[model samples]
Target: MKLSFYLHKNGAKYAMLTSIGGCISILGYLIYILNPLQLILDKLLTFQPGSLIFKLWTQPPYEVLAKIYIFNVTNSEQFLAGKEKLNLTQTGPYVYQEIVHNSEAIFNENGTLTYKPIRELKFRPELSVEDPDKARIIGPNIPLLGISSYMKNEYGLFMNLGFSSVVNMVKSPSLTNLSVTEYLFGYEDPLVELASTYVPSWIDFTKFGILDRLMSIDNGNTITMHLSTNTTSKDDILYQYSVDIFNGSPGLKQWGYREDIPEENSPCNTVEGAFESGVFPRHLKENTTVRLYRKAFCRSTSMIYENTDYTSSGMKYYNYRIDQNFLSTSEENPENKCFCKNSKKCLPKGFGSLDPCYYGIPIAMSQPHYLNADPEIRKQVIGMNPDQEKHDTVMKLSPELGIPIYARLRMQINLNVSPDQIVTSSKPFQGMILPLFWVELGIYDMPSYLGILINIAAQIPTIEMVTSYILGMIGALMIATVGVCVIRGFNQNRSDVESENQGLESSPFLSIPVQPIIRSEFKLLR
Candidate 1:
């Protein structure tokens, strides 16, 4: 009875332990199937539009650095000898300040999201040079009034000038005097009206096309956007943009493809997928190239105007091509009016041209000081010393989370100058793409919770296995203990029964009272 009671008590505990262990094992398997990216996406959607989380995840974290380049125009003779000389000015490291002019994130009726900015760029007064007098000039030092006028009027080189460069020779006011931040990125919102017309920069966002297409367009429909004049505001032109998206690729609803498609359909379209897959994720075979499209502010020119017509349009669509090796090459060009007609203009690895977008000036784009570009480009220019450590654009990311632990995007600006008989002032600068300035945008270290989340996600498998093993062991031990108790109880009961039987056989009630007394008693009875 004692053994039965003990077994009953332990048996209930064993059954409960078995059930708990089974539950834990099931949970362990589920942990293996956890999708961290999907979880992150779900959490991101919960934040308010203006919340810190929304801004951090949606907007770019660009810390601007203005690296001004100076050309050695003194050696006009060497440049005339088929050699180009350029140098970087030891100018103040101008840090840019930016504030969103309009921080409104509008949700459209079509289920798309749009954000507008008139001129979000501003110079932080506190971080900038305290003395306006001490602030360094941003553009070329040589007076180009005659040359600029000649290009503008005679060559029909009418185009807006980037704040970094002056279109006409008039000295621009001090950085403090210019109201640089008052303008809207787009004069009017593109999505406000569903019209298919082009919008200029003063009234519109110059680069909004990229953002719009990224979040608003349908898959089969090509993205179209107008180009903003970097400097000459004489004309407004729009161009067409294109990029192919395969089914199942990670893309927004704007792409109009089914979100439920299998990942094997090829290429990742979403922002997370792009970063994780290195911009183009598909059946990326060796040596194959992929084209990525984005809207950029390009300096416009008259030459491009003549070729493409007032379409000022080509600038709206500039693309960069990259191979599976992650190495990039320059886009193919029929002819770029902004580039030198005589030299090799093909963009090299790490170097892209804004020529298609801007014509009066030839702007070469690359990481700050030509980082990741062919060493020869830097070697030709005097002040262009590429530093692999600081200038290089590096992206170290978590493949699963599609978030970067460290990221840096650096772009250097260089202008090409060739002697043109049409403008005599350009005689000194012949066959040279002078380095003007470069900017850097960096992001490092994720939010604490995000970091913690990544860590927990990484350890989940181990946690599952360990917990399941421990519970399984406990359950097995409980069962073994129950078996041992049952066996011992059975043996004890058997021993007791055997002893009782032996005692019964010896009991006086079952035997004749006396074998010895039996003989005398039996004779008397007879």
Candidate 2:
């Protein structure tokens, strides 16, 4: 109303000025109230595919544990060997000796007249010695692609087509500075893609006891170290595996129990083959450490399933990133609900959540310290599985230390439907996305494309009322000033009329009217 009045009174100029003032004040007040310090925290929150915010939230006190094992793990490749040579011996006049046959000599240095390849050398990968990425040093007997024989025979280049590197173990007691990953098998850029990047050296020999003894290696135990950074979050589901390794191959042998995590399955921590013990040699008893830190950060309010087909969901989906703390509690009773609960690991009551991906004993990412191949002893140890069929599980499984955590577990959330999606806590998602994408972008990470909807729901229009009111107040004050001037003018005019009337009625300056007064008085008296 005041604004309208001002326009009529020619006070419209104040509107924009007052509005700008109001906006400034509003902006300041809103920022002051947010208190951003309260909202930021550190948790293991992964980037869920379908959400921009509110992702899988884990419980508090998830303890991260490390089991240090001292063992020697050797692969199929030989570091250094005696040379094969041709020699002549004297007996009678001309001692009978083996003829010059190149193919006959395989390993020994003393032969008849033929010198074979000296010794059939095991495969090794070519690698970059200079450390580029600041990561934990790698160890020996780890799995990786070896230099191919064809490439070595052709261009005289090392057989490794970027599939090897030297694991630098200066401080670590594992292997020496040997080449492990040089380049990807067929990759153009080694830095960007993960498939091009080779696995660490410790993945080669993953068994314990006779497994290493039978292969002629000293020790060949395998254990995975889960990091506190991201082991217990709502986003990632951790698992372990055993594999088979080629005796003469460069990297660690394949899984000694299972190749990889199984397809559409759960964790198998209770199972025996999931882990091994004493894989290292008796001569070297120092433990090797591998560390896996958090890499990608993302979040959402919803929990993403490893198996569910989220491509068709019509709901507004979510993804998020949140900094979380460790949440590990002791669950000693195997019969209770929290029986499987413990620090550094967990296995809930509902097991089906890990569909499309196998869940098993947790595995560890390689530490930078344990990298490098040693020039010391013996043979390589491989996985023991004789089955011809391949497994569908992809998660790695191991069972040495920490908790061999295989059991039924519950989902982060609980849902019921034709195909139900459940959520237990929102703690998994905080800080996963931006306000604009959650409220303005209108697109969800999920296929449903409902991010914009959530953004709109959280939005509010900027009101101009404060500015308008301020402008109206100023205009009204100006009009009041004009009214005061008009009222003063009327009072002045009335005062002047009153003064003129007093003069007219004052009898013409009675003193100067002496003669007229005498005449007037006489006429009155007569």
Candidate 3:
């Protein structure tokens, strides 16, 4: 009705009407058109992340992707198809990176993912969460992907009273190192594949041709940062192969495909007669919510025009009004301003909710034992990648105070620079999460009750087993002594008056001591 009414009333603005109608068509079908029973069942059974479709939203693996690190390999031969043998001089910045971007109102077709040689690219960035003002991410790999680099440092400072680096401490060296099984390759099997008869009419792609239309419309789909590090620079300037984009992968490309179908479990791999086996619980529904996310990530370069990224680009720091917040137990807003680095910028949190603040430590393959690590341990082992100079220097000066997570991460980044970039973060940020006393009542109660029950239960076993068997050994030696004492007493014919029996002190078998009486206030309980 909305569409028809608008068409008739403002048909004069034919272009706007036509364009909005086109969008409505794509979104309407992506949502109301598809059904996947097998996909739903598999997700529920495995409790895979996708089961959280309402929450996790397609399980885009943003955390892992955010942490991907890149390395550059200098080559003289043609590395990518249709490329040339270009030698990099032994000098300054060299390596390059690639970050992929896509936009299509919904999950895009696979053409974009299938190997495309490097095209236009923004500079690969070398960023530091420890120092947001120092974000240096650009096209390929000149030095950084400051976003991940910063979080890595923040994780490190929160972990060790030790050194961190903007460059070397990067725990994982390649993008492949950061992997998530959010999607199956749309495999076909009879269990997950329903009879063509049961399939719903709305989702029959052959008739609707949504996929064909999606690809044809230019939603400005693109893959950002797909270049190698130009490591051969004037040796004096800088020489390292860090590609912020592809995170070390040279020419490898990624692919995406969607099947317009449904089943009991999942629509992918079949198992135990079910359509598919699993989907991660955290991942969102592909059909219902995937299109909604299209806007969040679609990168409306238009929005970029409206707002300047203070922390990302080179901007004067003091110009924008500074704000803070406390996510921990204190008064929950940023309070008290402190002087920061001379350069201007903001932390992701400071930039407000422009984006979700994502942090991670790359899982290193060199030491595969990291598979079962808890979050804290993982942060310790993974560390950041600012460079040796930065990590070691800041670690020498303890950053925690009166400190917050963002501050600790920032001061650590401050270590790797000319005196000019020295800065500190004033915002109240959190570090590795720990239980706050008042907030975690549940954690305390369960253990105390279990201990009480276990204590009472242990008494039965203790008396039944130890009173005899263990007592036999201890009683044997004591019996002999008692007998000798009795004989001695008889020889004496008289005994001295018995000493006073201390209540609990005299009773050995089951004496219960008086426990400390807590004050009335402290004794309060739920």
Question: Each model's TM-score?
Answer: 0.54, 0.24, 0.15
lDDT of 1 by residue, 187-255 (tens): 232221211234243112223221122122212222211111113322111111111122222343222
* Each candidate's clash count: 23, 125, 93
> What does candidate 2's lDDT look like per residue over 273-316, in tens digits?
12121111111111212112110000001111122111132222
Instruction: Compare the candidates by lDDT and give the number of the best one.
Output: 1
- The stretch of ten residues in a row with the least summed lDDT in candidate 2 is 433-442
Cα-based lDDT for every prediction: 0.39, 0.22, 0.22
lDDT of 1 at 510: 85
Ten-residue stretch with the least lDDT total in model 3: 434-443
lDDT of 1 at 278: 18
Highest-TM-score candidate:
1
Off by over 4 Å in 3: 1-380, 385-526
